[model samples]
Target: MIKSIGQLFFLALSCLAIAILQFSFISSFPGAFNQINIGLIAMVFILFFFGIKSAILFIFFFGSFMDIFSFQFFSFHLLVLATVSLVVYLILENWLTNKSLYSFWVLCLIASVTYGFISSILLFVFSGLGGGFSIFSLYFWQSLLYQSLWLLLVASLFFNIFVSLAKRFKPFFLEKKGVI
Candidate 1:
C-alpha cells in the first residue's frame, strides 16, 4: 500500500509538471498558438501504465488545477478532460494490443481532435463570442492542424520514453505481476 501510494504521488507530480509546462508555454506565445498539450501526454502515460481509473483521476485533478488558474469557469476543463478520458477508456477496452505505436498514434489523433473540437467549441460558445473564428475557417483548420501535429510529436517522444522505461524496469515497472 505504501508503495502504491508513493507511485501515485509521483504520477500526480508528473501530471502537475506537464500541466505547468504546457500552460506556461502557451501563455508565453504571442499569437494564437495551439500546441500539443503535455497534459494529454501525461494522460496517455497514466492510462497505459497505471490504468483507466488513475488516468481519469489525474485528468480530473489536472483539469481542476487548470480551471483554478485560467479564466474559464471551474469544471469546464475537467469536463473536457473527463470526456477525452472516457473515450480513451472505451477505445482501449475494446481494442489495443501490445502497446502498438500505430494504435497509439491513432489514439493520440483521436484524443487531440476530440479535445480540440470540444474545448474550442465550448470556448466559442461561452467566451469567444466577443472575438473568434467562424466554425469553419482557415484559422480554425490551422489551429487544428497545429494541435494534431503537436500531439503526434509529443506522443512519439512519450512512447519512446515509455518503451525504454518498460524495458529497463521490466520486472518492477512493466511486468503484469509486478504492476500495482
Candidate 2:
C-alpha cells in the first residue's frame, strides 16, 4: 500500500511539473509558430501506463491546480483538461492500437485534434465569440497544429524517460523473487 501511494505521489508530482512547465513556456514565449502544448501528453502517458480512473483523477487534480493558478475563468481550462483526458482514455483503451509507438502517435493525434477543437470552442464561447471569435480569430487551427507537434515531441521524450526509469526499477521486482 505504501508503494502504491509513493507511485501515485510521484505521478501527481510529474503532472504538476509538466503543467507548470507548459504554462510557463506559453507565457514566456507567446510566439506564433511555437505554440505546442504537451499537457495532454503527460495525461495520456499516465493513462496508457496506469489506468483510466487514475488518468481522470490526475486530470481533475491537475485541472483544479490550474484553476487555482489561472487569473480569470479558471473552470474553462479545468473543463477542457478533464474532458480531453477522459476522451483520450476512452479512445486509447477502446479504439486505438496499444502497447506500441504507432498507437502512441495515434493517441497524440486524436488528443491534439480534440483538445484543439475544445479549446477553440471554449475560447469562442467564453470570449463571447470575440464579437467574432471564430476558429480563425485566435489562430485556432494553427495552434492545434503546433500543439499536436508539441505533444508528439514531448510525449516521445517523456515516454523514453519513463521507460528508462521503469527499467531501472526492474531490480526491485527481482528482489522479491529471492534472486537478490
Candidate 3:
C-alpha cells in the first residue's frame, strides 16, 4: 500500500510539473502552436503506463490546475480531460502492445491530436454562446500541425526516460514478461 501511494504521489507530481509548463511555458509559444498542450501530453504519459485510477487522478488534477489558471472556463477543461482520458485509456490499454519505440511515437501523435480536437470542441461550444470561436479557423489547423511536431520531438526525446523509469518500478499496469 505504501508503495502504491508513493507511485501515486510521484505520478501526481509529474502531472503538476507538466501542468505548470502547459500553463505558463507552452502557452507562451508566441502563436497558436502552443495549443499542443504539454499538460495533456503528460496526462497521456500517465495513461500510457499508469492504471485507470492514477490516470483519472492525473487528469482531474491536471484539468483543475489548468482551470485555476484559466479565466471563466469553470469545469470545461476538467470534463473534456476526463472524457478524453477515459476514451484514450480504453483504446490504448487494450490494444497497445508491450513497450516499443514505435508505439510511443504513434501514441504520442494520437494523444496530442486527440487533446487538440477535444479541447477545441469544448472551447467551441462554450464560446459559441458568445459567437467568438471558429473551429475551422486557420489557427486551429496551425496549432494541430505545430503541436504534432512538438509532440513527436518531445516524445522521441523522453521515450527512453519513461521506459527506463517504468523498468525500475514496473508500475501496476505493465505486464511482467517471462524470463527465458
Candidate 4:
C-alpha cells in the first residue's frame, strides 16, 4: 500500500507537469497546438497505463485545476473527460486489442473528435445561455481538422512512451500472478 501510494504521488507529479505544459506553455501559442487538447491526450495516455482509478484521480484533479484557472464551470472538463474515457473504454474493451497502434490511432482520433465536438456544443449551449452565440460554422470545422491532425501527431509520438511508462505503473486491475 505504501508503494502504491508512492507511485500515485509520482503519477500526480507527472500529471502536474502535463497540466503545466498544457495550461502554460501551450497557451502561448494560438495556432494548431492550441487546438490540440493536451489534457485530453494526457488523459488517454494516463488511462492506458494506470487503470480507471488512478486515471480518474489524475483527470479529476487535473480538470479541477484547469477549471479553477479557466472560465469553464465546475465539472465541465471532468464531464468531457469522463465521456471520452467511457468511449475509449467501450471501444477498446470489445472490438480490438489495446496493444495495437492501429487501435491507438483510431481511438485517439475518436477521442480528439469527441472532445472537440462535445466541448464545442457544450460551450455553445453555455455561451448561448449567457449570450446569443450560435455554433456550427467554418471555424468549427477548421478547429476540428487542426485538432485531429494535432492528435495524430501527438499520439504517434507519445503512445509508445506512455505505454512503456505504463509498464512501470503496472495497472492495478490485473492480478499479480505470473505464469512460468
Tens digits of per-residue lDDT, candidate 2, 38-156, equal 56776787777777878787787677766677774778767887778778778876887545666777788888888878876887788765655556655666677788888888777
Q: lDDT value for candidate 2?
A: 0.73
lDDT of each: 0.76, 0.73, 0.73, 0.75
lDDT of 1 by residue, 38-147 (tens): 78767876786678988887987788778877778777888888888888778877887646677778888878788877887787777747748345767766777787
lDDT of 4 by residue, 1-180 (tens): 999999878877777777777778888887666777788877776666556776688887787777766777677787888888888777767776645567778878888888877787777777756753334577777888898888878887886676576565234565657853
How much is 139 displaced in model 3, in angstroms? 1.4
What overall lDDT, based on C-alpha atoms, would model 4 receive against the true structure?
Answer: 0.75
TM-score of each: 0.79, 0.77, 0.77, 0.80
Query: TM-score winner among the candidates?
Result: 4
Query: What 10-residue stretch in candidate 4 is worst by lDDT?
Result: 165-174
TM-score between candidate 4 and the true structure: 0.80
Better of 1 and 2 by TM-score: 1
Q: Return the lDDT, model 3, position 84.
A: 71
Q: Write the per-residue lDDT of candidate 3 for residues 48-85, one digit (tens) a residue.
A: 76667777888777778778878848887788778777
Candidate 2 ranges with C-alpha deviation above 4 Å: 1-12, 30-34, 164-180
Against the true structure, candidate 3 has what lDDT? 0.73
